[model samples]
Target: MRRLGLLRLALGLAFVAGVSAARADGLIVSLSSREVVIASNYQGGSITVFGAALDKDGEVRPPGPYDLVVTVRGPLETIDVREKTRVLGMWINRRGRDFVRAPTFLAVLTNRPVAEIADPATLKREDLGLEAAAERRIAGAGERPTPEDAAFVAALRRLQEGRRLWREDARGVDFIGASLFQGEIALPPNVPFGTFDVEVRLMQQGETLARQTTSFQVVKSNFEARVAGLAEDRRLAYGLVAVGLALLLGWLASVIFRRD
Candidate 1:
């Protein structure tokens, strides 16, 4: 019994050490900024992400068959997509589909095309690519989508892409050195104000070796935030103040540029 106990203790220690070593060979990620502040003159901006793959000794791992996919998920909200048809003298709404909890902004950045990185099952399971990101929300309906539904999804992608709200790039991530990499996430002028989740995945041989999830926030400037808060908290005062500012600006503009 004493000998068996000793063997069991040794095995347990070895198992714990193995697990720790595996974790040590994982990925670490950081962002350039944790907040995206939108001002009145804000056009657009981008955030850079830095990452490193480390080994058991906390040293940079040697370059090998490694892959990284960075997916950004913005705030979720209800979205309604409508189709219009030409009628007698106007365009009329034909039908529409409602997407619940759809991401307001989404981008998938990868070192290379996802299809070349992993098998289809792995990609779908990890929601790594554009197609997977599009179908995932509705995939849990327990029924296969028909051709018409597929069209709606395609249309949705087209619309969001046009608005620059959804993006996918095969060559967005790049490795600077053996185990160091970086990628940039873009924010358009009309980017929604909310929290965004960033998911960083490290893959090897179609298997996810490491994963990390972090978040950042998008918000208006301090003045805008205070103004909005005031409006919400004191509607009457806000309205008066807004009107007063408008009138004052108009008067000053007319006086300054008055026929001179």
Candidate 2:
């Protein structure tokens, strides 16, 4: 994981440098903050991204000239979505699909409906929307998703959306000025703690003009972090301590409530 992160960082920097040397006008983006700390009272919040599209002469163009797509993706993981059936007055797992390399969280924000942003082929080529987010390997090593796999994919999407872990908001991006724009990515209270990659792509017609990638970290608060670390680092000790505390509390409760 560490090596992969370093490799991604190197590639991002190289991509940015190449774009800088080759293009005169493009997209510039900045987030409100680079880190989001999850507190005890964390209900929910939004990550604000401010950006602008530059013209050839280094000028901000009007809204119609370019379209912006903001995609925020959390760490990738495999998930299984199972289908249940009732048989003989009991519920049992019938079958399931394991979606590999799926984003734990996904948010695709656009200024307008994604259909108006580009053609389907173009969208697929650029990996622009919800479909793109789920277009990954299915089951084990098979990268192709069979036609019947659509239902599983839909179920997977439904489950994620229900948990507020995946969403697509057409109106999440707003144009503040000619070329200036801002986008808000919803971060649910139960958001996964990890590094999230934010990609802002500038599209004209059905072609991509420029893209900027950045990342932010979501982490636990100090006390929570310490507790999590203790649990992870000392499983046996932590389990013993937890059981002892529960037993102690139960004993005290019984002693105080006992009647003569």
Candidate 3:
């Protein structure tokens, strides 16, 4: 029985070694920080993603033309896209569409124009470009979208861009000496608190050679978390506390500025 156990252990080790050897020819990616805490005064921050390509023998590959794209996607949320039209000299809500499971925040960073790297179909298939990111849809109120819905979708993209919730930078990632590459992503103050996925793609001759992903968390600080919990768990007490604080501040301001 001891001999059989030893043989099984040896086989398992061999299998693991084979798998590691297979993965050694691809790319490896890393992030500087894997978690971020947002305080009450969190303005913004940035993260650096660095990676390198390895050959079959696990050594850095030789210099060559390689394209890199980095994408950061935040939590998903349902959004409503609405259009307004002037009726009788008053603007009113007209047509609207609901998009489910849309990314609350999305940022794309590329070394160069994505068009110069891959074709439209390839980009769409890989969801590499902003247009592909905005094409997400869920079951709507109807069977299919009408021709007029195109305008609404465009409007939604424009609104998101204006709010800085969505961003794309063509010259964001830079390759250093052919083997190593680095990219930076700026997290806005209003970045949603949830799990964010960071994806890195290595491409050559318009074909994706390797892809890797890492995740990070955006969480509220301890004080903010406690306050939010209080608000949700003890609504009346929280409201009273808020009111008391407001009154105390008002009185203090008046006392400081009063004319004798």
Candidate 4:
């Protein structure tokens, strides 16, 4: 009888440990830089995002066949998409839809094909892929989108891709060993200035084991900052300054090309 009681207690303790291990399987993510400066002559740059897996005891574990996904999203903005119609043999904008709080920039990096990592429903629920991201509609869309609305969304995605503001790289993340992984995200020259969120997800067997998020700032340099502040805080003064500069440039041009 005592032996039976001891066995039951041992089984219960083991079960509790197993549950704790499952709960502790998590990811730790970090970025090389927390802030990025966009100077007047800034073109573009890249940031390194890296992370490791943590065991139940909160210790780094040997690297496994874990999948990693890194997503960088910029500040949201209201986007207006206009559809054109041919009128009198000329194309003219006739209808438009406004997408409020749409991400101005989005870049994704994955160790493997996203389809192989998660199902369509899971991907859509987590916004894990480009199609999922594009399908995300904010509030005030008035009604559920129709086929035409989908077409407009596709057009907008194409435009973003052309500008290099949105991208997806299949081989972007690389695993260094059993426990560590890293990825790179390219910041285009035209990346908007604002706070950007970076998300790292670790998945196994089509299940998200852990996820973490970090943030960084894209800020203008001193000169650009001053100009932006003036434009926002003192619009009249900014306009006057712009006009003064234009006049000065015109006068200089006239002198340089004076007929003699």
Q: Which candidate comes out best when scored by lDDT?
A: 1
Rank the candidate models, highest lDDT first. Answer: 1, 2, 4, 3
Better candidate by lDDT, 3 or 4: 4
Top-TM-score structure, candidate number:
2
In the range 197-247, model 1's lDDT, one tens digit per residue, is 998888888888888777889998999889888989999999999899999
Sort by TM-score, best first: what order? 2, 4, 1, 3
TM-score of 3: 0.79
CA lDDT of each prediction against the hidden true structure: 0.79, 0.78, 0.76, 0.77
What tens digits encode model 2's per-residue C-alpha lDDT throughout 1-260? Answer: 64653444344335434543223357777666679998889898877776767777767676676678999999889888888889798999887888787789899999887889999667756768876556553575345566667778778878899999999888978776477677778899889989999988888786888888888999999988888989999999999999999999999999999997
Model 3 lDDT tens row, 1-260: 64643344344335424433223236777666678898989998977666677776767888688888888888988878877889899999987787677788888899899788898778867878766665545335343446666666677678888878788889888666657666777888888889999888878988988888878898889999789889999999999999999999999999999998
Model 3 worst lDDT window (10 residues): 16-25
Stretches of candidate 1 exceeding 4 Å from the true structure: 1-25, 87-89, 139-142, 240-260
| Model 2: worst 10 consecutive residues (lDDT sum) | 15-24
Regions of model 4 farther than 4 Å from truth: 1-25, 138-145, 249-260
RMSD of each: 11.5, 8.2, 10.6, 11.9
TM-score of each: 0.79, 0.83, 0.79, 0.82
> How many clashes (backbone N, Cα, C below 3 Å) per candidate?
0, 0, 0, 2
